[model samples]
Target: MNDTLHVVEKLTEWRARALEFEREIQKAVLGQARVIRLVTICIFARGHVLIEGDVGVGKTTLLRSASRALGGDFARVEGTVDM
Candidate 1:
């Protein structure tokens, strides 16, 4: 009985923490909740993401923001015409 109660308590605490985390992400990422959600899903699933966009389209900003939020390393490199 004590163990079950402890598990339920921990779950409740995690739920509250998750809600707070979602709110923080929303605050940091304005007007791109969908993109944030997709990124979150990818991270949750342990998958890599390839963001395709033209220059100055917020791709780097989005990836960097996501990396900061997820507490990981972020790196960027410019591409050239040579293959």
Candidate 2:
């Protein structure tokens, strides 16, 4: 019983942190609330995400914003074809 209560308390704290993180990202990202929430959920779940969108659709910005909000490092990789 004590262990279950501890787990629940930790989950509550994590949920609060995740909500705050999402709000921080929202300040830097405009008109992408759904995407931001999805990203936040992914982060909380400890899952990887692959974001696909048209060029100039703020994909990089989204990740960077989230990273900044979480006080973590962000890196981007570009693909190129070499002949």
Candidate 3:
């Protein structure tokens, strides 16, 4: 019971932080709600994601914004093939 209570408290705190992170990312990137939400999920899930699309679709912008929100670095690489 004590352990469960501790977990609940931590989850609540994490949820608040996650919401704030989303808000900051949104402010930095405009007109990409779905992309932002997907990035947010992948970020908290601690997994890697491959964002692909045509040029000028905001993929790089979204990832860069997310990296800034997470206080992380962003890098871009161009490849001959898509993975």
Candidate 4:
């Protein structure tokens, strides 16, 4: 059916895009390959992730780097005691 063909085409395009993104991330992140790969797998597997660590441990760096690699939008939120 035409609808099926359209769906297939869209999926193919999306997969290709995700692959390209993975390559870009690999290039940007020189070290920390394991962490990066884990994050990537989590994303693809549709699993939720919680990264907790002391400050200045590259948490934001990892997210920003991944965002750039994925060619996608990135948003950062800070936790507050009141909220």
Instruction: For residues 1-83, write the lDDT of model 3, one tens digit per residue.
Output: 99999999999998898889889988878888888888888889998899989988888888888889899999988875665
Instruction: Give all TM-scores, in the order shown.
Output: 0.62, 0.81, 0.84, 0.60
lDDT of candidates 1 onward, in order: 0.72, 0.91, 0.87, 0.77
Clashing pairs in 1: none
Ten contiguous residues with the weakest lDDT in model 4: 21-30
A best-first ranking of the candidates according to their TM-score comes to: 3, 2, 1, 4
Candidate 1: tens digits of C-alpha lDDT, residues 18-40: 55555556765678777766766
Query: 27-51, model 2: which lDDT tens digit per residue?
Result: 8889999999899989888999999
Which is superior by lDDT, 1 or 4? 4
The candidate that wins on lDDT is 2
Cα RMSDs, all models: 3.5, 2.0, 2.3, 4.5
Give candidate 3 misplaced runs (Cα > 4 Å). 81-83
Q: Give residue 33's error in model 2 in angstroms.
A: 1.4
List runs of model 1 lying over 4 Å from the truth. Answer: 1-22
Model 2 misplacement above 4 A: 1-4, 80-83
In terms of TM-score, which candidate is stronger, 1 or 2? 2
